[model samples]
Target: MGKDLILQAGRRTITMETAAVAALEARVDDSFHRACELMLGCSGRVIVSGMGKSGHIGRKIAATLASTGTPSFFVHPGEASHGDLGMITRHDVVIAISNSGSSAEVLTLLPLLKRLGIPLISMTGKTDSPLAQSADVNLDIAVETEACPLNLAPTSSTTVTLVMGDALAVALLEARGFTAEDFAFSHPGGALGRQLLLKVADVMHAGEELPQVSPETPLSKALLEMTSKGFGMTTIVDSNGQLLGVFTDGDLRRVIDQKLELDTATMEQVMSRRPKTVSAHTLAAEALRIMEDNKITALVVEDPEHHPIGLLHMHDVLRAGVI
Candidate 1:
């Protein structure tokens, strides 16, 4: 009705849900452990099913589990009855979500799951409901009250269900020793995947694109190389093409401050020696960290013998979405 009343309602809802989530910590007891064990031991995919709002949470839980190394997918309880039940297999495990724990559509699938000897796990608000009683392991998702002022809508209960799903996914992820690389594989199209999977060689400018000059080269020539390569820097190499140092825009400023003749200056005299370097095999994400920590824009990608093979620019990493 009024602005104060609307704000008060929103705050009250958040406060109630926050308390409900806190209560979930205590419920993560033996039952939670057993559920994780069951899912971990599943030889096939973990099948998740529910109805209405619970179904929405079930789909997210399945997605989280699948991304974190646990193979899973969501199936609507209503659809499962209409030939979709064929999707479930004897080797798989089932996680059913229903606040009342008596959803008839979900209950109908129990007999079939039992016939196949599939492990049954239930997240329910009522421990004594049929679904809970039938499950091999029951996770208590019961909340004290709904966040709705009427105490009728599935508000606090749904939030608790989603959080419980996250806890289960994270726990199983750690138990399975799932790594960031593993997650990247599951999400190859995202920025996070690029960060974790891309190597310096994959994003670095190599071959003809690398800006390099010999130590004996004039500062003017090195500056031209830096400009042509668009890297804002050029590597100084020895006769054998081994990295000796680097000349950058920053060096140009210093040379100007000293009133040196750009034409008379040599790469060896003006270059910053022993510049920071990264191997081509290094992770692009790690290379970004190196640049940020050292306050540098570029890194010389070197071979084992310190030969300049490529140039890794911060822009290159960002372009590849490593950040």
Candidate 2:
């Protein structure tokens, strides 16, 4: 193939991948609903099982389920006959995946899977296979053909199975009212988790580390506080600790060019009075957006009544990986 032909073939691969996922949409029926209901009804984890290529897809599906607010784990069927059958329990739900529904190792576990009193959800290309017939709910994951030239590789089958898994997981998620916060709890170190769960209060410098000054504080004194705190800005607050505004190094430079008396000028006279503030409970990523929009580097975290509680700096947001 020519270079252009090769590029067209690569694009065709994505088309095939997308079409494989799209095919599972038509299979969402009462059986799909029953499968979701069965999995949701379980008190223990969803145990995904398969062999060979399906094993790899099953692991990915289990991970998707777990991250999307469902408790799930993948167990290799071959290992189950060897000793891993102990991992299955009466309270657990088993999702057996076999493109042909006749994989020996997967078939080997079904009888014991039934003995455990666990509900079975089967994903297979053939709905009439023994595994599918035995399942409490059968999810059809058939596809048109594989991307492999001879239709021998598991490409299309794997894609449809994954899409079915995602559908089940999302359905369960919605039924349980699982919000972004719930998903974040499961993935505390992931970017999505940080964006949803990390609050200004969690990342802000609070208590003694917060650099602050009063509106009446002299410009020189405010500058000293800002320099010592290393936040590039210090909040100016009133007697009740309500934020009045902010004074920063940039403001000082402008005041100097205007020849304003640093010692005589109060921060209230030189500060940016219309400063932006965020609630301590706001997400850190949201705070980063507010800062980027306002073209400012620091924000004072305020209480519901608008009193300053902490300082959120750009450097801290960067360190937290919000950027």
Candidate 3:
């Protein structure tokens, strides 16, 4: 009834759930390895099915598996009886989740799945349950007790189930040698996609939008180019269009402090030479790292011939969500 009592109860729940999850570490033995091996070798997608709270966790597990290189989807046990059983194939692997491991909807499909010759993987708190006995590989997700005070709510059980699901998915992912670039393909709308898939050329200002001036150009003229291009910096290039140096607002401050006349001083005399340059094909994420490490706000994108082709500013990466 009191605030301290409620807080204490909450802490107990967390401790119970944490212990339940930790117990699963020992269960990740031969059975877990066999399950991962089966899922990895499956030619068809993994069909995850469950009932009640287990179903919710199953759906999330399926999603995690799908996004992390394993082809998978959730199939409600109830619907599997109502024509959705047609979704299963001989090549597919089925992951059935149930704390009791004897849900009627799931049990009804055992015969059909067996007849179809599909491998069945069961996750249950009771390894002695019917589902476990029928499965090709049984993943024991047994927990000591529920986090609920009355020992009725599916608190710790569901948490353990979810963690076991993650273990299986991650094992398969690592076994497949799935890379970040491969993950980006599955999530083109997320930040990871932008980080791994977007190239410097994709976000950099190119052609007429590039702020550049010849090395012999006056500092005042370079300032005009920087302002016109709105990049706050201008790249200095040789007559043949090869990069020579860069002049930024920082350089302008130095010139002013030393009493150099902007109109009369050439960029070659005041510019920072050997400016940081990146390839047009380089990933935007790598470019962002380079800028952050050097404390610069912009970089020049160059072609194979060392010609300045584009300019990438930190703001560009920010707008593209690469940051």
Candidate 4:
């Protein structure tokens, strides 16, 4: 085959898949809506099962549903015939995926599923197939052509089926009013989780680790506290422990330019008044945004009363996976 022919075929495959997905858009009729309703009303998890390529897609759909606030899991239809059907319960809804909708492994479990009164949702390219006819809800995933040049291999058909699954998961996700915070709870080990759920209080250095100085403290003495605290900055507070100003290396450079006596110059005299501050209750992601927008590396964590309770540096949020 010519190289250009291969390239042309590849582009054709992508076009075919796109058209298949477009066809699915119009196929989302009452049957599609009923399938979503069955899943939404299910008291137990939606069990997705299939064989071969359909099985792989089923597993992905199950995972997507689970992560998006819909309770779900995947089961192998072949395994169900061999005693795994015990995992299926009357409270659960079964979603069987097959392009032909008549795989023997799936057909073998039909009677058992019916006996248990489990509602069945069938996703298939053939509405007349056995699985769709037996199902409580049939979602027709028809495709005009296969992306496969030979027209036998599953291609555009599978792509449209997977997209349909995504549509269902997202619809359920919105119907359930799933929030970013709720999604973050399901993914607590990644940066996304930290960004949405982690608070400034969770990452800030408190008490002895916080570098603070009174407004009247000598600039030289405040620098000592800054270096010891290892934050390269110190918050200047009043006698009442309320934040008054902030002192950093930027202030140090200006203080030196003014030829000020370090022993006589107080922190308040050299500090930047009304500097950026964040509440401990704020999300760590918000702190990162503030730092990026302000071009700074550190944030003072204040309490409700505007008192500096802790210090949060860029490294702190980075280490906590907020980066």
Candidate 5:
């Protein structure tokens, strides 16, 4: 086949699925609201079950729901028949997905689910199908046609099902007032977690690692502290440990431009006064933004009292994966 023909085929598939999703948007009725209400009111997790391609979509939906503050997980319909059905409790809610709403594996569990008195939310293409008719709430995910050329494979139908799952997850997320910090708690090892949950104090150089010098200290001594600490900068403070200013490599270059002798100049005379400072409790990502916006590489981490307690450099942010 020609390359252009392959590209055209891909475009047609996307167009078909896009139309299918747009149609699903119009069909979001009271049943969708009832499903969300049931899920929100569930004392146990949302148990999602499906067969074949629908199972794959259910797994993703369950994961999204769990990460967005709704406790949920997927159970394969085949596995549910074998023993996994015990995982479902009456306090939980079940969302069963089937393109035709007549999968034998899914239908087999209906009687048991009803016996348990658990709520069932059905997602299917056929409103009159066995699974939909047996469910407590039926969500129609019908598509006019399949994206597959033969109209046999589940394409547009599955896309609509996935979108409907997202709609339910986001509605529950908003109803629960889930915040990014809560999402970070569920994904502590992910990049978003590092950006939102990691604080500057967690990564900044503190105590002996903090490079500091007295305002009256000679610039040469401050340079020694900068070299020893390997932070490329030094914070200048008073006897009370109050921040007086900061001296960085850029300040060194400026001093060199003025032809001033490092041994004779005091830090207070050569340092950049009132250099950018951030609280130790500030988020590392916010610190990174302040550094990027000011085009600076280092910031002094202070307490609420304005006393310099630590130092943060760009490398620390990079090491923490906040950059």
Candidate 6:
């Protein structure tokens, strides 16, 4: 084939698959609602099963459901007949996927699932097939044609099935009020989890590492502290160690423009009083937002009594992967 023919084939496949996905929006009707209801009301895990290409889609669906707080897992239909059938219980809901709605391996488990009184939901292209007929709710995933030129591949069918699964998972997630924090719990190692779960105290420089100066401290000394800590700023505390103000590299520029004597000027003379601060319990991601909004790079982490306990730097947040 010519290069142009190959490019045309790829574009045609995507166009066909896109149309199939668009058709799904109209098919999210009563059956889709019933399917969501069954899965949402399930007291135990949602068991997803399929055969062949359908099985690949099923695994992805199961993962999306599980991560979205549905509590689901995929079980190969072929394995379920060989003692794995014990995995399904009366409390669970089953999702069976098959484009033809007559996958023999998948159909083999329906009798057992029915005997156990488990709710059955089916995603199939053939509404009249045995699998769809057996399901309590059949989600129609019929596409006009396969993306494959010969109409023999699972292209458009599989895309529609996967998108239908995503629709179901998202609908159930909203029904259950699943939040980002809830999602983070399921994906603790991911970037979203770190952003949601990590707090200022978890990544801030505290105790001896914190750069602090008293209001009476000379400007030269404060600059030394800022340089030593490498935070580009330092907190100015009162006699009782309460945060009184903050001085930063920005202040240094101002002082230079005014030609102020750094050796003689005290922190109280040039420090920004009542500077923006964050509590140690504030989320690192929230701190990043505050930093971006104010166009600043660091924030003073304070205690309940307004005492400076630590310093949160943008670099710290970035290093912790909370961004």
Top lDDT hit: 1
TM, every model:
0.94, 0.91, 0.94, 0.97, 0.96, 0.93
- Minimum summed lDDT over a 10-residue window in model 5 is located at 20-29
lDDT of each candidate versus the true structure: 0.95, 0.88, 0.93, 0.91, 0.93, 0.93
Better of 2 and 6 by lDDT: 6
In model 1, where do residues sit more than 4 Å from their true spots? Answer: 262-264
Q: lDDT (0-100) at residue 54 of candidate 1? A: 98
lDDT (Cα, tens digit) per residue for candidate 3, span 210-251: 988897898888898989989889988888999888899998
Please give the lDDT score for candidate 5. 0.93
Question: lDDT at 156 for candidate 4?
Answer: 89
RMSD, model 1, all Cα superposed? 1.8
lDDT of 2 by residue, 1-323 (tens): 79998988778877997988877788899998898889878899999999988999999999989988778999999889999999988999999999998898999988887887789999999989988998988899888888766789888788888788888888998999998888889988878878888889889998988888988898888889988988888988899888888888788889989999989999889999868889988999999999899888889888888888899998899899776
Off by over 4 Å in 5: none
By TM-score rank, best first, the candidates go: 4, 5, 3, 1, 6, 2
Which pairs clash inside model 6? Answer: none
Return the lDDT, model 1, position 16. Answer: 99
| RMSD after CA superposition, every candidate | 1.8, 2.1, 1.7, 1.3, 1.4, 1.8
Return the clash pairs for model 3, or none: none
Per-residue CA lDDT of model 5 for 224-320, tens digit only, reads: 9999999899998888888988899998999999999989999989989978999989999999999999999989999887799998988889899
Worst 10 residues of 2 by lDDT: 142-151
lDDT of 1 at 230: 93
Highest TM-score: which candidate? 4
Error of 6 at 54 (Å): 0.4
Question: Which residue segments of model 2 deviate by more than 4 Å?
Answer: 1-13
Q: What are the per-residue Cα lDDT tens digits for candidate 6 across 272-306?
A: 99888999899999999999999999999999999
Q: What is the lDDT of residue 26 in candidate 4?
A: 85
